[model samples]
Target: MNQLLNLRAQVVKTLLSVQQGQSLSTILHQQLDQIAPKDRALFHELVLGTLRQWFSLKALTLPLLSKPLDNPTVESCLYVGLYQILCTRIAPHAAISETVTATKQLGFPALSGVVNAILRRATRETEQFQQTLNQTHGLPSWLYKRLKKDWPEQLESLCQALKQSAAITLRVNQRKIGRDAYLTKLEDTDVQAQACPYADAGVFLKQSVQIPELVGFSQGWFSVQDQHAQLSASLLPNLDGKTVIDACAAPGGKTAHLLEKFKPSLLIALDQDEKRLNRVTENLQRLDLNSDHVQIMAADATTWQATRMVDCIVLDAPCSAIGVLRRHPDIRLLRQASDIAETVALQKQILQNMWQQLKVGGTLLYITCSILKAENEQQMIEFFAEHPEAQEEKIIADWGIPQTHGRQLLPLDQQGDGFYYCRIKKIA
Candidate 1:
């Protein structure tokens, strides 16, 4: 219990730091690494859940607070406590008492009354309080307006989807084992699972379980990956026995998928950070997909030059990650509206630079976990306009998907992430 409390305190501190202008994930990494393994996991759940539902919780708790908590640390601690009352099944009394005790430990004993009162009110009038929050959309005004304007028909569904917890998915490593054999092995171990539609070897877990507990996990039968992220590999046609580049492929999820499926002649996984590249190597090593066929390089995708033109290229450019707000709520709070322009520019530079490396008739898969039109459709539109040689292949909307310039898969669906992908072929 002390371990949990300590980790929770660390998460609260990290949240406070983020509120005070520190990088969200960066500030939490070392603190999270210091906790025990199980505590670390719980810390992640609590912090992520709390952040994801913050607006709603705040709406309920604010009216009950006598005044603003004033201190950021105390405010964050109160938010954490209120989150437990509203989201978790913890006994209301224990949640309140323990959290108030935690505040005292954090040198905010004076605010215990405020915490106790707000949490007690939250528990007592749960539905009424929640209804008020729910009616208001539980999002920042700017974000709510943006969603409504962009997806008028689907805004409610999209917002609700973003509020729910994300599903656990696995990217099966076909290099070591077949998908069916692995599914059977998982079922035999009492793990409920199903095959994801988009990827050849992807699995959707019916329940959340630790990755290490899965059969053949240590042997690398599969690695955790969203079904939506696997789309990049599927979009690349005729990849077998050809050279390919996975640009910005750190922690190489897509890189491994490419290797597992196509077993390409040359797979160069490039990312700017050398340290993160270690995760790519680790993932490949576990999948038994690590081979002379693949090369990990540390270089910026925007500037990296290939010695010879490759048959295919994947530029999974980084963006605001708005499409995945449910999984990473910190992103919504972390990003500013202006960040999209710079991201689009960088993506253009990488696309133009890497387009040079793709031989005529070769396809470049441009993908991002972003739902914004500027980063996805508008970027692709402008790209196609500038490069008359490239043609836009629209992903059909009758597929029960939203329309964007390219393929815009909502995070709500079975086989998609809030992803945007365009398979641009270079004309000779």
Candidate 2:
């Protein structure tokens, strides 16, 4: 096998699966081992870039097509080639030749001509072709229409932001190293980083690196979390000696933060997936924050609750996850307009079920990685109507747009991932 060509071939297969409705994260996680460690980064870049800009490439290639190709898998292979040409820094001659060679490796020797012709024409014309010529902003019409309706003024900027990669932000575990100390350490190692504007303990890495290789990673000096998400645990107030539950907590970034920052009488971190719950345990153990007081449970909060009402509760309610599109580009392809309504219904059910567990004076912080009104504000509206006892507590923050019932951080927010937070206090 041509090793370099083989890497591109693997990327083509991954792209095909993503185009077939499989998520890029799942497919890449399962297939990463098959790729040589040296090539994994490029493999990820090619596959993710292709998916993120699928339509942008379509705008460039559609006219160049001799005709619509029959097999989408073959078309996917061509997309990997074209993505390398138009989007990546790969030299055009090498990108085109290597990708065409992979067609035979992918068992489509006959389609090599079709792939070759389109990519060659792209290199010749793409320079001037992209000059006011690329109109499609790489969004499916269904998503574009919905986003336009929801955020008429911001949709264009949001779409542009979605095509870019997200910055890797870390929440420094003050237990191991303070944020300022970590900033100095990053400098010593030539890793470019700076303080996060919002979260005091947050560090924004100017250039991303493999998480494990960062100094003190083994000692749990920090956790890879979005700067916006780091605020979730901070929104809860005065947990000293109070019972708290982080419902839907998994891979527990917020759970770890809550434990690290406050002395809770009992902190029960619950998530439905047993496998994912283990991830929460791993994170806690690595941070040296896990103890008897912090119990990791694999139970669905919507269906399960403790005998006693907790003083503080975190419902990081699952929703469409439409907000984190920059980090999870596959969402653009996999998500449908209908998924929003389905997710809204489930979020409402979870909110209703979990509200019963909050003490009269207790606080419940509702969060989602979705900016959709259906999942954010409108859900708050419906929840308020059904539960007269629930009052929207003000989120007195300097960041996020203040919504009628909550604050939402759009994706383009300088130092944040798209997030929505609604703090409520039970006042009946």
Candidate 3:
């Protein structure tokens, strides 16, 4: 089969069962072995880029055609071609010719006339075309409207930020090596590194580098974490040798950071998924920090509780992950307006359950990879109403991109995921 046909087949096969909450990159990686390495790279780039800028591309292509292309096969074929011409650095002629040829090869030879006419018009009407594309394609109207309502003053900036790619940040595991020593080791290998200002152990790469290949990584010198997430560990005050709980800890990024920062007397890490929790074990084992100092349990935080009130608890509540859209483009297509309500309810339940496990004067740092008010600010507001004893700590005022209730790191800026955090202290 031709490269384009193969690409289309993969795209269709993946999207066929595109359920909510599945990772786009993980799905693509599963099918990667089928295509040539070069074509696989280009195929993923086009699929993700087209999804990222779907609003923009459809806006550009719609005017040239009389109406929407209803057939999924024809529409995807068109997107395969238009996405290349508009988004990629591929020469317009090459993009158009190759895409048209692929349509014929993929059992749509009759649509060649339609594909040629649309692409030719797209090239000919460049200026008027570009403006329409911008007006329509830059942001999905539903998301744009919601963001505008929520962040009136900063909506434009937020939209721009969400559209760009996220930066790769690493949290240095001080158990094996300090930040300065890690940087020197990286520089020796010609990897560019810069300190992430907010967290002591955090570092930003000038270029993306594979983590396992870096020196000390196998020994647990560092792990990939966003600067915003690294701050989640820092928000817990008076963490020294205390009993701390990382409820809903998965892949153990935050749990490992907590282990490093607090060196807590007891660190109980709990996650619902056994497979995902194994990831946390892997991270801990690699760093040599997975000791009797920590306890890993495959349990749901919504109901799980310690035998006694712990010194501190980090409740990284689940929510509509509208914030990390840049890193996971699949969310843009899979998320629905209704998903927010269910997420809010789940977050609320977990918060109430986890808060009960916190001892007096202990802290519960509520966090989410979400920008929605229903999940962040509004949820916090409701929690305060129910529990008058809980008070907002307001730990880091300027840790991330500014938001009304808590700091939100935009994915577009700082090259980080969109994250929301609010810390609460129990006084009663």
Top candidate when judged by TM-score against the true structure: 2
Q: Model 1, 1-428: lDDT tens per residue? A: 33446555777767776666666656667777777876777778778877787777666667666676667777777778877766778787877887787777777887777877777887888787666756546666667777787678788877777777888889888777888988998899999999987667789999878789788888888899888887677667878789999999988898888888886889999999999899999988888884688889999888889889999888889887888787777765677767778988888899889998989888888888887777887888788888988875555433325444566777765455688788888886
Judged by lDDT against the true structure, how good is candidate 1? 0.78
Candidate 2, residue 233: lDDT = 71
- What's the CA error at residue 411 for candidate 3, in Å? 3.5
- How many residue pairs clash in each candidate at the backbone level? 0, 0, 3
With a 3 Å backbone cut-off (N, CA, C), the pairs that clash in candidate 3 are 55-137, 56-137, 167-415
Q: Please provide, for model 3 over 90-178, each residue's C-alpha lDDT reduced to its tens digit, 9 standing for 90 to 100.
A: 88898778767766766778877798778777677666665665555266677778787777877767766665567789999997888
Model 2 per-residue lDDT tens digits across residues 1-428: 43445777888877778878998766678778788788789888887888888877666667767687778767887878878877789999999888887887888899898999888887887776555234567787888887898888898788887777888999999978889999999999999999999998999999869889999998989999999999987788889899998899997989999878988989998889998898898998899985779888888766886888889889999887878887888888789888888889888878877889888998999999997888998899888888888888899989988988999999884577789999999998
Using lDDT as the measure, the top candidate is: 2
Candidate 3 weakest lDDT stretch, 10 residues: 12-21
TM-score of each: 0.92, 0.96, 0.91
- In order, the Cα lDDT scores of the candidates are 0.78, 0.85, 0.77
Off by over 4 Å in 1: 1-8, 21-29, 33-41, 394-404, 413-416
How many clashing pairs in candidate 2?
0
Model 3's TM-score against the true structure: 0.91
